[model samples]
Target: MKTLIVIPTYNEGSTIERVLNTTLEAIEGDILVVDDNSSDATKELVRNFFDTGRVFMLERPSKLGLGTAYIYGFRWGLSRGYDLFFEMDADNSHNPAALPWFLKELRGGYDVVVGSRYLHHTISVVGWDFKRLLLSKFGNWYAATLLGLKQFTDLTSGYRCYTSKALKAIGLEKIKSNGYAFQIEMVYRSHRKGLKVAEMPIIFYERGGGGSKMSRKIVREAMALPFKLRLEAIRHIFKDNI
Candidate 1:
């Protein structure tokens, strides 16, 4: 089955081309970059790289949030007949060479495969402070506990593979949240729909080229996530009664 990797980018001029080249050379499918109209030369760089197929870009008017970027890209990917869909980090933290493992596992009859950093005794995150690690760890624990999803290790993991079936089950129409929490909510909703999920241990190296997108605002949203997710789950379960 053919696959499409959707990378959402914002002001990644310093690293976009190298990341694209890395993915295109290592993987066996289309890499569609949903650029958030980065103020830099991100869109232009991709456009000039290829005069044709495989590597493509969709330019938005401005920074439209990560959730919307992926949602737009997912819809675009579905329309193109890509049987499998993927979301990955663009700053080289998510290894392009490891992509085949996700596809191979998906072919082995799983609906979704997550590249997890906390599984199988692998603490593969490189170059992170303890405080940042603690924040992610606590946030992930709270999200999974509140939502009752047991399959996901890193609830906010951006590296994942989805069969067309699983993606359809998500019904992007239902997902909320803009950045980090978006990943957590997707995993929760996928579990609710009974999609089979598997995890592959991976090294989530910290981004080497540019500043992280995470901000104080995103952290505050993530902190409130457990309570928010629980309430949403309860509402979804009782929507028919209301």
Candidate 2:
């Protein structure tokens, strides 16, 4: 199947080349970097790889949200008739070596395969502080419980693979959230639509360079999106029953 890895970047110049090269070595597919007008020469660095024909980029005017970046990449892949799509980090936190495992699951008919850090009762995350870890664990629990997605261990995991059909069914253009909430919403929608979702354990490391994009606004959005999704589900049920 034709695969496309979509990496959303902002000031990721320090790590983009390594990530791109490693990803290319691991998988035989195209890569699309949706850059948000990075000031750190990220675009120029990526352009060097464009001559290889396996790498492509989309430069946004400003720092758009992560959700929009992925959405843009998704649409681009869809237009080109890609069979599989990946959401990977450009900062190398998510290992490129895991690409084969994800593709294996995809070939096995899983609609969505997520690289989970909390799967198998083990905390596979490295380089996270206790406070951040606690918040992450609690946040996943809260969102999963409220959204009725008990089967998934990592609702907010960005390292994931989606089949083309699954992406189409999820309605990419309709996605609203931009922060971590975007990840949760995609999984929830896939589960709601009865797509086959699978999780594989992966070690998530802290970025080696560039600052984290996490902020108070992102946290707030993540906290509220579950409630919003749950209410929407309820409304849909009520309307259908009526």
Candidate 3:
């Protein structure tokens, strides 16, 4: 199957080149880097590989949210007739070595496959402090419980893959949330559509370069998203009944 790995980057020049090179070695598919007008020469680094035909870059005017980047990438991949799409981080946090496993599951008939850091009994995350770990765990738990996605152990995981059919079913253009909430919203939409979703264990490492994009605004959006989604669902049900 033709696969496309969509990586969104902003000021990730320090690690983007290495990440792309490693991904190329691990997987036999094209890659698209959606750069949000990075000032740190990230676009130039990716352009070096464009002549190879296997790599491509989409330059945005300024800093856009993570959700929009993936949405843009998804649309681009869909237009090119890519069968499978992978959402990966530009930083080395998500291992490219795990791509084969995800693809295997995708081929095995799963509509969506998530690389979970907390699927196993022992924590699979590295370099996270206790406070950050707690926040992550709690966030996942809260989202799953509130959104009725108990089957997912990592609703906020960024490492994931989706088939074109599933993305189409979820209505890509309608996705509004960005940041961590974007991940949750995708999973929730898939579940609502009754698509098959599976999770695989993966070791998540902290970024070796570039600072984190997490901020108070992002956190606030994430915290409010689940409730907003739930309310929307309730409104839909009520309208249908009426």
TM-scores, all candidates, are: 0.94, 0.98, 0.98
Residue ranges of candidate 1 with Cα displaced over 4 Å? none
Q: Write the per-residue lDDT of candidate 2 for residues 79-186, one digit (tens) a residue.
A: 999999999999989999999999887777899999999997899988999999998999999999988888889988999999999999998876899999999999
lDDT of 3 by residue, 1-242 (tens): 89999999999999998999999999999999999999998999999998878999998999999999999999999999999999999989999999999988877789999999988666899999999999999999888988888878999999999999999999987688999999999999998898999999999999979989999988888899988998889999999999
TM-score of 3: 0.98
Q: What is the lDDT of residue 33 in candidate 3?
A: 94
What global local distance difference test value does model 1 have? Answer: 0.83
**For model 2, what is the error of residue 162's alpha carbon versus the real structure, in angstroms, after optimal superposition?**
0.4
Counting clashing residue pairs in each candidate, in order, gives: 0, 0, 0
What C-alpha lDDT does candidate 3 achieve relative to the native structure? 0.93
Residue 14 displacement in candidate 3 (angstroms): 0.7
Residue 41 Cα positional deviation in candidate 2, in Å, after optimal superposition: 1.4
| lDDT leader | 2
